[model samples]
Each structure stands twice: as C-alpha cells, then as structure tokens.
Target: MTFAISKTASQIAPFRVMKILAQAKALQAQGRDIIHMEIGEPDFASPSCVHQAAQNAAEQGLTHYTATLGLPALREKLAQFYDGFYHAKVNAEQLVITPGSSSALQLVLTAILNPGEQVLMADPTYPCNRQFVHLLHGEVYSVPVTADSQYQLTLDHLKQHWNPQIKAVMVASPANPTGTLIEQAELLKMAQFLAQRDTYFIVDEIYQGLVYERPAESILAHQNLPQNVVVINSFSKFFGMTGWRLGWCVVPEHLIDVLDRLGQNLYLSAPTLSQYGALAVLESDALTELEQRRQIFQQRRNRLYAAMQSAGFTLKTLPQGAFYLYWDVSEYTQDSERFCAALLQQTGVAITPGTDFGKEAGKSHVRLAYTNDRIEEAVQRIQGFVEQYR
Candidate 1:
C-alpha cells in the first residue's frame, strides 16, 4: 500500500550525512575496509558511571513515564550546570527535556514560526538546522560565513538578512561540522540587536564542553532577563551518549508550558533510562570523566591540525572548539563529495564533504572529524592517503 506523507515532508530530501554514511557502510560490508570519518560520532562509549546509572534506573523500574517537563531532579541539576558553566542562573521551571536536541529544535521552530516565516542561521554550519526549518514549513535565510571570521556568524550578517517575516535566529556555538564558535562580544551584540525587535533568539549549545583552547561560552551567560534565549544542550556530545536520545532546553517561563505540552505529545519524555543516566552527568562525578576525555580530544585536535597542513591542504582555521576540521580542498579538487568518495574507496579513508554542511562553500571543502579514540591509527592512515594523492 502507498502510504500518505505530508506535503512538507515530501519536498525535503533525507539528511545528506546519513545518506553518505549508508553508502560508505554498504561499501565496507563488501570488504572495502573504509576508515570512517564521514559520520560525526564519539569514538568512546558512554562513561562507566553513566552506564551504571542507567542500569540502576532500569532495575528500579524507573521505566515508568516521567513528567513531560522532565524529572525534577534532572531539571534542577541542569540549572546548576547553567550557573556553573555560563555563570548564569536558570530556574528548573524554565526547562523541558526531550528525546534529543534535534527534536527539541523542531518544537522550538514549531512553537514560534508561522508557516512561511523565515528562520535565520549560518549556511556553513549544521545541515540539520536548515532541515528543521523546512520541516516546520518555514524558509531559511542563510547568513554566509567565511574562514576569515573563523566561519562563525556575526551580528553584522544578522542585520543583512533580518526581515519582517523572520521570527527567530538560530545559532550554534562550537557549531557542528565547522567547529567554529561565535565570539562572546559578537554574541552579545546579536542578542541586544534582536532584542530591539520582536525576534526570538535560540542558541544551540550541544558542543559546549568540547572546546580545546578556550571554553565555549553560552548565550545564557550574557543574555538579559525574561530570558530571550531559548538555549539547547545535549548529553550526546560531552557524555558520549549519542545513542541515548537525550537533551534539554531552557525556555522563557511563558514558553515552558507550551513546550511541555509539545514534549508530552511528541516525545512523551526523553528515554527514562537516559534521563536517569544524564542526572549523573549533571549532578555527580561525571565532570571528571568528561575532563579526561577533553584532554584526549585536545591532543587529537593538534595531531590532525599538523597532518592536514603538511598534506598540502589549506588550514583555514584549526578549530578553536568542537572536534572537527573544516578546511579548503579547492586547490586540490572542486567536487568535494567525489573527492571524499574516491578517497574513501581508494585509500580506505572517509571524510564528510563541505557540501554536506552547505551548498555555497561546500564545493571546495571537506570536514575531517578527529574522533579517533585510538587516534594514531587514524592519523597514520590519513598520512598514507595524503602521500598516495601526491
């Protein structure tokens, strides 16, 4: 039987990363022996304490449904996290936990945008942000970012694209794929400017704790009261719990009730076990485990930086935050997707094409995920691939 689908759903294509990943996986299944860098996932498993917490939760029959707003304990702990990291206090009443940050984004877009409204974001950033806009029947106004600006969004660019139909501005710090962050000064300027109008401001902080050189700042640190920022965070990155489908958002007090209703209808509540596990992340000794991993990622980031530079590709920016390297391959090849695919086939190396992030700058770029838990082997394989290309 032919199944029915929404008109909006029919118009959009599948997430490009997953499509490429599926092709790469299929090739590997044929004994291709691909060295995976195409997908963005942590190499480490969830920290042992987190796993133990999940076990305890399941054994306690915490499997029963929780408040749509999230378990009270988890919410309180996340509030403390805001105060600690961002140096800003958030009430638990402002929080709503959802299946994943991805789903949280959908509700934020749906809650605010009228059909045909515009949602603004940087083009050379996350692909899924654009997809979320489309899924909500909204248009995207891409703010073009350049390597000179560290590929981060600026307040000036915000003004260039802002319009009457635009309802919100979506930005990610330590942004996905690019791994670039919006500077705190620029972030404040953008927040203050948006406050001049009725526009909503949403900040995605999924990569908050992954920074290497400098700590990634949160919008909560600087935004004014009545909390104009709808801040999002996830357990997937820092907790090494990507498979857990857990995330939280802090809305304006007025927005929380609406978000809770949406959470109940859409998610029911983030997986019960993951919620209990993330409680440990927010409230317990999880920070020590996270810090240990951070040191390792910092070293891998340095290793990948040197390797890419010596390999003859340009070092546009050596990612100040997040675990990615978005650099130019234009001097070597124009078709990044084909270059990546051929490299994966020939050298057993898989890196994501720039186009997977955005169509404008993507033609000449590729993103290298330095997610090597056993990084030496990944680095050596990359070094070998570079020599062969010579």
Candidate 2:
C-alpha cells in the first residue's frame, strides 16, 4: 500500500547530524567508547531551582494547559527580563511563548508569508531556517556569506538579493555551525534598511546569553526598530532547559491576535510545568549558575579551537559565542560528510559534517559542538584520527 505524503514533507531536507549521531549510538551499543561532538545540546542539567519548581508545580497539580499565548505570569516575567536585561521596552502583549524556538520561528513565518513569496536568509545558517519556509510553501533566497562577514548577512548582500518577491529577511546571531555574531551596528543598519522598504525582519537570538567576548543584543532592543520585525529566543541554551522545550517570540503588537489564534490551533499552549520552571530560571541564583556554565563552554571552545588548529584544520571564523566550532577541513578532505564518517568509524568520535548546514562551501567544512564533558579525550581521539588522514 502506497501512502501519499504532502509535497512539503517530501521537500524538507534531513538533518544530517542526526544520521551521524544514530551511527555513533549504534557503535556505542557495540561496546565502543564513542565521544560525541555532533549534537548542540548542553552537557549540564537544568538548574536545581528549576527542577524544584517543576516538582513543586507537579505536586500542586498545575499540569493542565496554559493560556495559548502563555501563562500571564510567565509572559510578565519574560517581559521584565528583557526590560531589565536590555532596557528593551517589551510589553507582555507582544510575547507568545511556544514549545521551542523552532515553533516560534514557524509561527512567525506562517503569520507573515504568503505562498510562493521569498524570504531572504544567510546561506550556511541553521538548515531548518530554510526548511521552515519550504513547509509554508515560501521560497528561501540564501545569500552566501563568508568568514569575513562572520557568516552573517551584510547590508550589501541584502541589497544584491532584495527583490520585489521577497517578503522577509531572517538571520541568526551567534549563528549555528559558525557561532559568529552580527555586529550591533550592522544589525541596526539592516534594520533601518528593511524598515525603509517595509520588509519583515526576523532575528533569531536563541544563543544570546552564551556570547563570550561581546554581548549579543536582540533586534527588539533596537530603538525605532521596524514594526514588522520579530525576535525569537529560547530557554534551551544558556538556561540549560533543552528538554523543557520552552521558548518565546516577540512580534509586533498588531500580530498578537493572529499569533494567539495560531498558537491556540497549533499547540494550545506551551508545557505548563516548563513555564513554571522557567520562572525560577529568571531568578538571581539561576542566572549565576548559567553564567558559570557559560564560562565552562568558553573554556571548551578555546580548547577545541586549539585542538582543531593543531590537527591541521583551520577555522574560517573564530567562534565568538555558542558552543560550536566550524572548521575548514579542505586540506584534509573536501567532502566533509565523508570525512566525518571515516573519522567516527576509525576513532569512535562524532562531529557534524558541514554539509548538514548548507551545500555551497559547506562541503569543505564541519561543525564540532563542544557540548561534551570529555573534550580533552575527544581531542585526543580526533588528533589520532587526523594523523591517519595526514
């Protein structure tokens, strides 16, 4: 019996890292000591306070559905967080909490895009960014960016690619695969450019709190930001709440009703217990714990940067934030997916092939997520694997 699938489902690309991770898991089951560096989840657990909050909520039987937009208290807490942290005047009415940043992105895209319209994005970004557009029957126009631009889209790139068909421009800062950020000034410039044209601007700030050298600011914090702009953020990264599956989006006030309806239909609400736990995550103690964990991630980034360099791989751009190091492995192999497969099979170590991020220029690269506790051991195994190829 043949089952018919929608064209959207058929066109979506697979996340190649999961395939590598599955193979690594199979090897581990066979008594192999596989050191994982493929996935982008933190090794740390959620803060104790968060866990306790969830437990307490469960004990009180607060496990039912929340308001479609979110619990009023959670939305208020998030609004306060943005105002206190960044001085961004965010009102609770503009916030819509979702199961994760992924869904927040989906809501924004679905709310703004009409079928066959184009959305501009940087190439070599999070693969799902484009796929989400495809799921809505929207076209993705990828502007190829390089290390010089920190793998971020530039004003000139936008000017070159901007067309009448384009409806939105989406970007991720402290971007995935590269972990580089768009400078605040450049972001403001892009915001102004889009504002003048009345084009929609979407900024993914999921890695905001994890920045190392400089702080990553949200576009919503930009004064006089375009009314069409939307900001996507999550509790999964710095807050160490990956399994909680909680995140929120800041959209124009006018879209709140539309988004509320979409949220009602799509998820009804975010997880009730997670919302309660996230309230504790905003407490002073949780912030301190998260900052300490961030320092550890920075240490891992420094160690991995050094290790990959010593192993004859050059990073195109040094990672300034997030827990990933994207490497240029052209000298060792042009086919990164093949290189990753051989490395994992030979050394029991896993890294994400750059091909998982993008096709152009991505084939010569790979992404190593420093989310493991055994970074030194993974480094050693990686070095040994590189020696065989050299």
Candidate 3:
C-alpha cells in the first residue's frame, strides 16, 4: 500500500537556494560557465592542520563511536574555544557537539517545544531554520525585520509578536542572507525582554568569529548560563569547514541531560574524522589561515558593494558581517526568482533569489553572495547583468 506524507511535511517548503544551486550545477555539467554566487559556503579549503589531524586520527584507527552527545575531549575543546572567543563562563557540561549546527538546533527545538508551539525569528533570516522548526512539529513565526531594524531582532518587534504560545525566540547575530549583527544595546534589550517572560532565547552564532564590524559582542557576553540561552556555533563560515559538518550548541545545564538522551537516540554520534579536524581548527595555528580568509571576504564585500551600487541596485543595508549584500531589486523586478534566473541565463551569473528567506522575501530583493572562487569574475558578471537590467 502507498503511504501519504505527513501534513507537517506539506507545511515545509523546499529551500530555494538549493534548487537554484542544483540548476546551476546541471547547466555546468553540460559545460556552461556560470559565475557561482548563489551559495553562501566559503570557496576555500580547510587548513592543512585540519586535514593532518583527520589523517592522524585515521592512522591511529580512532573511528569507533564515542558518547552520543560528543567526545568529551571535543566538547571540552569546543567549550574552550567559546570561552576564549565569547569570554563567557562555559563548561563542557553545558555543550553538545552535533553533526552540524543545523542538527543541534533541531535537537533543541525537539527537546523544548511541543506540537504547535511557536518560535519567533526575524523574517528574511535563514530558510532551513524555518524548515527545521517545522520538522520538529513546531510553528516558526516570522517578525518582520526591516532596514530600520538593521534586519536584526528588535525588542519592539518581540513585544508585538510574543505570546504564551511562543516558547522560544531564535536570534541569529550575523544572520544568514542579511549578514547583519544585532547591535549590543538591542541584544541587551532582547535578553531582558525574554528573561522577564521566561521564554527560551536561542542564539545562533555560527558566524561569530568571522565578524568584521565588531569583534566580541556575543549574547553570551551579557547573560548567565541559566538564563534560557542556547548558543549555536559551527566549523563552517569562519573556519572554512562546511563539509566537515561539525558544530556545537551550548545548552543550559537543566536541558543537558535531556539533550544527551535525545542525542543518543537520534544522532548516535558525530563523525570522528570531522571532530578531529575541528579540534585542530579550534586549538592550533589554523586561526592564521582563517584570518587570511576573512581578509579575502572582507575585500570581496567591498568590491561587490561598490559594483552593485554602481549598477542601480540600492544597498538596503550595508552588511557588516558575513559575505552577502542584501540589495533591493525593486526597480529591476519585483519577482526575485525570475530576476535572478534571467540574470543567470543572460550573463552566466548565478545568484540567490531573496524569496528563499521568507514569504515577504520574493518581492523586489536579491541576495548576492560575493565570496566565491571567481569572486572578481562574479562581480564583473554581476556588474554586467545589473547594467543590462538598468
């Protein structure tokens, strides 16, 4: 007998970036030269030290499974990395190393939220984040974040959106798509608002160490560990280890036991090799390599911003961190999917459509990811496409 998909699955939409990326790949497989800029992954290699660690671990035959939560050593090292970067009082017991930050978030949502419970986030944030929430049978609510809000969460927005049904607030500093960090004052305000309501406050800091605008403005810098905050981080972005799929979540001590149980039942264990690679990336000279990558992306952002502005697209918000420029394409076309698709076919430049982020997203906006292998070439191509559109 044939089975039907769950009603919940219907609510979850496909990530538009993945679809565009697939189309670009299919065209390239037929030998078309498409300037790649749709995906946000770093166009760099993991440092040699990371690879060497993986090699050493493999040589020592250390691939057997460990604690489902994570290896104690990796968890401790991750805490050390956090303590060094965030200067927060963190212990290994407050952390869980999942396969990726994505899974870590899923575990948190699953552990804390019941069916129909709502989690609040800024609209036009990350696509997969909403999907993950839906997969956990939780409702993901979007609070409209505008350029006025710096595309980050604001306390006013929270007050308007908050309710008893709301179980958590998912805030991403250096958020995906927008690449904007929440200002310090706004963060403190948000922390206070959520703290009073006794709702969960989750911070996605995967892009923490890569920040260019400010160095150490973590939410962890402002709160006690018991204040209902779970900090999510990753080896991707800053460390250039997307494929390694290693990321961690710092949970409150109360949730630690439940997460450990869920981690055991759900994930079994994170990859041993990736853990080894992450350990080296976190505690070695690999920081130098990561810093060099930041310089390259920072330069690319400057170039892309100038080029996009010259091409008639208005920079709605000059991104302070991350590698994207969220530009308003209203004058060019209201339909971002069609606009981006036409640009690719016409100029061989593939860019992500803004609609991937939220419902309000598909209209008159485009997210151009400038950190690619042919970053210079991509900008030149984007300049040509923008000129033609103008």
**Ordered list by TM-score, greatest first:** 2, 3, 1
In model 3, what is the error at residue 161, expressed in angstroms? 1.9
Tens-place lDDT per residue, model 1, 232-330, is: 888888778899989888788878878877877886877889899888777777788788888888888887877666555568787877788887877
What is each predicted model's overall lDDT from 0 to 1? 0.80, 0.88, 0.82
TM-score of each: 0.94, 0.97, 0.95
Candidate 1 deviates by what RMSD?
Answer: 2.1
Q: On a 0 to 100 scale, what is the lDDT of residue 168 in model 2?
A: 92
Task: State the displacement of the C-alpha of residue 332, model 1, in Å, after optimal TM-score superposition.
Answer: 2.2
> Which candidate's lDDT is highest?
2
On a 0 to 1 TM-score scale, where does candidate 2 land against the true structure?
0.97
For candidate 2, write residues 1-390 as lDDT tens digits. 989898779988999999999999999999998999998989898899988999999999999999999989999999999987767889998999999999999998999899999999887889999899999999988887888888889998888888889899998888998889988789888878887887888988899889997654777777777787789999998798999999999998888998999999999999999999998888546787888898999888988888767756666778999999887788778899999999999998899998888888788888889999787788788778777667
Candidate 1 residue 81 C-alpha distance from true site, Å = 2.0
Superior by TM-score: candidate 2 or candidate 3 = 2
